[model samples]
Target: MSWTDERIEQLRSMWEKGLTASQIADELGGVSRNAVIGKAHRLGLKSRPSPVKATDAKLAKPAKSPAAPKPAAAPPRAAVPAAPRPAAPPPKPEPRPAVAAPPTPDGAAPVPKPDAPRIVSIGPGGFIRQGPGDQQAPIPPAPPRRLVPAKPSPEIADKTSLLDLNDRICRWPMGHPGEPDFHFCGEAVNPGFPYCVEHCGRAYQAQLPRGTRRPPPPPPFGGPRVR
Candidate 1:
């Protein structure tokens, strides 16, 4: 709305009286708070404190009164002595019969008690073996261990030459073909295998049933020990 002289004067007076822009807008009909503010700014009326800040200051809680000093603590009460407990009676000793020793001939000595049976450790895990007598019988020398001879490998001369190779014969190569000594295993092949019984044994190994396979032998003593 256009600001007439009358409305402008009213706005200046209201603004100077500490009225908010909204209040001035309501007082001057046909004008918005922004319009009133713009007119007041143009008129160069003295700027007033912000109504929001003034309301906040007025609404703010007053400083709390200093807390009252706490009262002094009461003195501790005296403890009363408890009545003494009666002492328990002492236990009576039990009666036991005296044992008498057997009589012996005047010059004879007393016989000694038999020795306790002794245990002999034979192996690991505290294995104990009782012998017929007080002492353990000597462990018989371990039966002499004999090494079983390994099956001799097929001789190179026994291997079949390329010219002699046949479908029924083992096709397992014995040696490098580039060498003059190269030959094929000439043994009879298993029905479905490409190699003979021995060659097949070396070629395709069957997995042993679980828990049936033997553990690898321990390394010999005096060698590097595995931690």
Candidate 2:
């Protein structure tokens, strides 16, 4: 619907007066709520918070009326004065026992012992302890670990094995042979490699860049050669 100058002014005024898009749309003839919203947005209108919805309790309550003023209460009676009481004398304080000081030669004062190393309380539920001198040479760092290459499993070479061997299963030894959990990778072999894509990458890490083009292997003697 076309927005005339009069309709646009009315829309701006109603929007400024806190009317919702639906209400503005209803007020403006031949306009939808979405249309009003779009026009308002294009006009860079500031958005107001949605008016609070009226609850059933509020809607059900009747409007309160002003009540008639009540007559002022009679003046309160004057209180009778109480008689003054005689003040009693304060009791004397008892004498405290004398402490015996350690006797030193020539009236020299006794020296206090050195305090033990303290654990100081820091921020919420935290504590800081005074460390012993040198603290055991700051714990020498561990040696750098070596990445040993995965060895081929001897079980893959044996033809009498019960485990069903496939051309796809990765034959690399996974962990230490002495460990109970030691196993071989059984993932599908990558094209032109004995290992899977992952193990092939690991096996040829220093040799080649990944995804490099390679010539296909020659076909078997009895099979037809592929171009």
Candidate 3:
């Protein structure tokens, strides 16, 4: 609604009296609170404090009185002394008497003492002992062993060269290559072998019993020597 001169005058009077915009709007019909506030602002009417803020200030609780300083703690009291106890009596000593042996009758024979025990040692070197009247003879060194001569290799009269080699012919190599005598045994090969019966005998031999076998020779000082 338009702000007529009378309505503007009434709004000014209510605002100056500290009445809210809503209250002024109710008094002047056909106008809203916003319109009244706008009219007041144009007229340069003084602004009023908010009613909500005023009510909050009135209802706010007052600051609590600084808690009375707690009374100072009471001072500690002095401790009392305890009575002294009596000492325990000393313990009595135990008795231990000396023992004596009975005297022997006349013409009686003296008792004999036992002989010292002998110490026996057993290991890779063999059994040995040390004691009086327990002497052991020195062991004799083993005798030198004689080696049996090896059988001479069979001579292949009809030697087979590499070109003439076949499944049915002996393949045993003889004499080093690059030599005029180098050749393979020409004899018929044994059933399942690539060499003749004589060559196969040389190729495979029965293993000797463990007791009759010789120990391997020691390696050369610098390293192993090629044969």
The CA lDDT of each predicted structure is 0.78, 0.74, 0.80
Specify the highest-lDDT model's number.
Answer: 3
Candidate with better lDDT, 2 vs 3: 3
TM agreement with the true structure for every prediction: 0.30, 0.23, 0.31
The collision pairs in model 1 are: none
lDDT per residue for candidate 1 within 1-227, as digits (tens), equals 77778877787778878888998888888878888888888878878778788789978959789999999999999999999999999999987555455557895665544545465758676776657775676898989889885543355456577667777999888777677677787889999888899988898888999899999887788579669
Q: In candidate 3, where is summed lDDT lowest over 10 consecutive residues?
A: 149-158
Worst lDDT 10-window in candidate 1: 149-158
Clashes of 1: 0
Off by over 4 Å in 2: 52-227
Better of 2 and 3 by TM-score: 3
RMSD of 3: 24.1
